[model samples]
Target chain A: MTRDSTPGSLRVLVAKVGLDGHDRGVKVVARLLRDAGIEVIYTGLFQTPETVAAAAVDEDVDVVGLSMLSGAHMTLAPLVVKAIRDRGSDIPVVLGGIVPSQDVEELAAGGIAAVLGPGAPADQVVEVVRKVAASRS
Target chain B: MIPRHNGGVNSPRQQWQKAFDESRLREGPFQTLSGIPLEPVYGPDDGEYPGQYPYARGPYASMYRSKLWTMRMFAGFGTAIDTNRRFKEIIKAGGDGLSTAFDMPTLLGLDSDDPMALGEVGRCGVAIDTLADMRDLFADIDLGRITTSMTINSPAAVMLAMFVAQAETAGVPRANLGGTLQNDILKEYQAQKEFVFPPRQSMRLVRDTVAFTAAEMPRWHSISISGYHIREAGSTAAEELAFTLANGFAYVELARQAGLPVDSFAPRLSFFFNAHIDFFEEIAKYRAARRIWARWLKDRYGATSERSMQLRFHTQTAGVSLTAQQPEVNIVRTAIEALAGVLGGTQSLHTNSMDEALALPTEKAARIALRTQQVIAYETNVAHVADPLGGSHFVEALTDEMERRAEEIFAKIDEMGRGSILEGCITGIEENWFQGRIADSAYELEQNFNRGERIVVGVNRFLEGNDDDDLAILKITNEDEAKQKQRLSKVRSDRNDAAVRDALDRLAKDAVDSEVNLMPALIDASLAYVTVGEMMNTMAGVFGRHVEVPTI
Candidate 1:
């Protein structure tokens, strides 16, 4: 997808990808990215992987950010990555929330561009997304 | 000036002030996180005694002197059997009460084998699809002898029905079984988002449970109006107090509207709060909460009984405050928060495990968390005094400030509903008023931490030599989900389909009328082995599912 908005500005899609209703983290991240000059689209709670992938493709965003706090990150994140890939798109996905350190390597090797755990600082989150978006672009 | 002396020697206050003026103080805002200003030292203040009306000092005259707060650790994972083993361990390890955590699928009223329940069954808590699971959950445990608190809402009525049926089958009379049901559905919309039906329909369900429990089970606490999720969702301490008490009032109105006497059901209502990391502010919040609840129950709701006016609550150390980085430091954080809960006079408490920020607490972590509470209760000598911080000038001032701010919020909500707290809560949930305020507070706190104005020990300021890679966390494998599916399938196949259909039909028909109490029908359904999903679906078919008006 070509740059649809400002030439250098990145568009990131943040979402809550499971039955977990804890959206405080995702909503805060959306604001942080927005304040950092990134155009962001947030898919609210109870979103399935298929729905999130379809939204990412439909919005034509530079990156997809999935927030899974319900310990379903291991199972749901991979499905989301595969769903995005099967949709004929290679939008890099960044995973965040209460993911254990042991699962970080597996998630990265399973097509996730970045994995941010709980207490990840705003700068780290923003820089990770920018780096991934730049690499994909 | 002839050796001016306020007293025989220099007065203690004057001497302290002289020393304080000479000592160089650090640059500071010198206020609580909730923005209440604090004084370096407190003076005498005339405060009410413990066990009085309004109960500002403490709810009971003796407080912990009479009995220590129950160390109710919230335990659940994998399946009912897995959680049952944990419950047995807790009871053996000096725990007096059991608190159950349901998995995401069970919490949302979905069967384990449902497509929507994929990857979620038995992950966060125990998965209960039928009364069989409930019975297995308490297999060797005696229901009449021990009390269990189930942290399940939205589908709480069904869970209660299953519990009642399980107890009766085990030869325990319904009246003898004691426990608490977290039937506070209003907060689900405002913060937790685990709701199934719309606001009005959910209130009807809550009303039904209140009426049912009041008439039958005298030992059961009908609704535990909660603010823990609200605070965890990122509200200020005052918002948690205001919103939770407002919700308590709404439940009272619902019960009164159902033609039940205020004293009959009001005494059974309880509360749950979050004891956050702010030491003095959390204590002040708890104090203010009791005062507000007692006064509102007596003056606003017109309750004559003291039991009806008393605001008894369970406190859980804040889960959101734990950090994944430097996980061990969370023990210290939990200790401080638990102390605040104790000093604030909570009836029961749950401390967060050190590794909770990363995953569901492992066995060792949960045991240490329980030990933290034990040390406070046994070693600290904090329990010897009731409302230990009662007369401190700073604490008294903060308590007043919390009450003032909460009353302002209540006034706004009252205006929104034109007087009824129940209607006000419905309006607040509908318009996303509560959601927006909570989100704003969460954003501000994040921004503060991001800018280095706030110092989180591991995350922001002290970022050296912290390694969590070696920390062994609990991993819920997919095997549990597969096994849970098999159990659910077997139950579905073995149960009489005709009987299940009949029970569900009766529940659906009874649920259509607002005046009808659905608990009896729910108990009948549980006896017939109708699954949670079947009962919820039957009711949802009548009430329809609630989709939130998204607020970002």
Candidate 2:
């Protein structure tokens, strides 16, 4: 839990929203972010949007990264973003998983800051997290 | 200067060492995923013959030459009607067997209309809330003719009860119903995380199901001991083999403690494995799994029948290997993995779709995935020979090493539970031992890929433009959810509420008594049109919900 000297040393909440149990990608991303000197609060599997929004605000994370492999991303992602906004927090939301490219615009329209699909390397993810957290700061 | 390595007449080991030294191959070590060093050649004693008592070459003597493996394409998404259409389409597309994939809600023992199931209804796979949904899922397919494999855990008995009740209504004899239920719950706590109850209570439920199925459905597989999800969760092939077979042994021990003979139920046990991109390693895993299971079943459990000792399995091409960047390349990956499965002598196979990394496969992608297997069976001529690479030095050595590594893992697990695989797995799950190992392995794999030690064609090395948009991903909309909800609501309104309540009460009572099997009550509840949530909640009253202790 040591804080790095970097200004953009982001504190992010990585969560698995809804009943989708696939967490290998989410766990990997969390490790990569931690390795990149970021603080990550991972709400384990089978969390709801309400719990996620509350955790994001309570943990005071700079960003929320929602990872879903079950195609329920379309349904789960928006609810998470709306829940965050409903909590009166403008913290940026970044989405990752087996998201098809065609749905990127729709997810963006729902207030997602960025969409990272499978094979997005750890460096690229760290870059995205840094940029998103910097914007919030 | 090179010591005439190529032209050497020395012993194979000395010649190999000379070439190894001369070539300066010491720059880096070459090892398998399980950390076994690669050897130059293997001797005759490296492995045993196929169909022997402790079969290492394969489970069967004849293998695919006698009959080709069953192409059981795992397909299900949307409502039962939607999946029924897909089922008919697959059967028409040369698929011999059907593997059902239930939606997340169904997997977790929730009705489609539950609040927890709001956005997930009919999304990942088909949603079955009541007996009607099961009836609709098997609409055109004959239960007596086509062998169906249902991939569901936690709520497996509820689904099995529904399938049985549906069969009764459809006039199919109970003895004629044949298929596999992915009732392996230990792995859920270990890797998959789709569990509903705690380990001890969950084992009791699984025991009831196994005991009931063994007594009633002679043709049905009580459980498909699975390593596929373990591999997908990022374990090495050796870990997958060790953990899965260890779970199988736990189930056997549980059944034996319940007074069921090992032979009566062991023959009905099947296995499921993942066919990853590591070609030779994957083949060796299957070979090792058979040998290990055979020896443990015969020597440890005291099983006399050869049928009880044989380890038959179903293989699915690794979904974790598919990349979203160049989705089309997944076709090649799947073909290679599927070939490995065939060469490994899988009893049945499932080929993952090309677009899986992006979304649930589109119709075309699913067809192409099935065709991948068809081509291997028809054109490659790989199936004509049994254990085709059985005698290869690399494969035999790898197979032996795989068995040895798995045995080490088993011993460690045994130590954790005071020399009991069943108790050890439960403790392992509670302590997060299995999850920790899987997380470490997954992290290592990703780190290797990121550091350039491992190369995934589209993901790491091949710098291709983003072709992701070209894929036509299957999208389940809000209407689909609404439609499924409406259907569930109608069933709720139409069914006899009092009958449902009574049946559920009886189920809860049966679930409480450890000696009493809950199958009969489950069947009654299913026939009463009680939803999955209703039945699971009834049992949950007796056995509380499982809360996982975080290992992260």
Best by lDDT: 1
Query: How far out, in Å, is residue B348 in model 1?
Result: 0.2
- Report the lDDT of model 1 for residue B200: 92
Model 2 chain A — which ten-residue stretch has the worst lDDT? A1-10
Q: What is candidate 2's lDDT per residue for B164-270, written digit by digit as tens?
A: 99998999987899999999999999899999988888898789889988988989999999999999998999999999999999999999999999999999999
**Fraction of native contacts in model 2?**
0.63
Q: Over the stretch A1-137, how does candidate 1's per-residue lDDT look in tens digits?
A: 11113345788888887799998998888888888888878887788999999999998889999988999988899999999999999999999998988898999888999999899989999999999999995
- What is the fnat of candidate 1? 0.67
TM-score for each candidate, following the candidate numbering = 0.92, 0.92
Q: DockQ winner among the candidates?
A: 2
- Model 2, C-alpha of B403: deviation from truth (Å): 0.9
Question: What's the C-alpha lDDT at position B251 in model 1?
Answer: 94
Which regions of candidate 1 fall more than 4 Å away from where they truly are? A1-8, B1-47
Residues A2-121, candidate 2: write the lDDT tens digits: 122335566888998899888788888888888888888788888899999999998788989999888888778989999999999999999998888888999999899999988999
List where candidate 2 sits over 4 angstroms from the true fold.
A1-9, B1-48
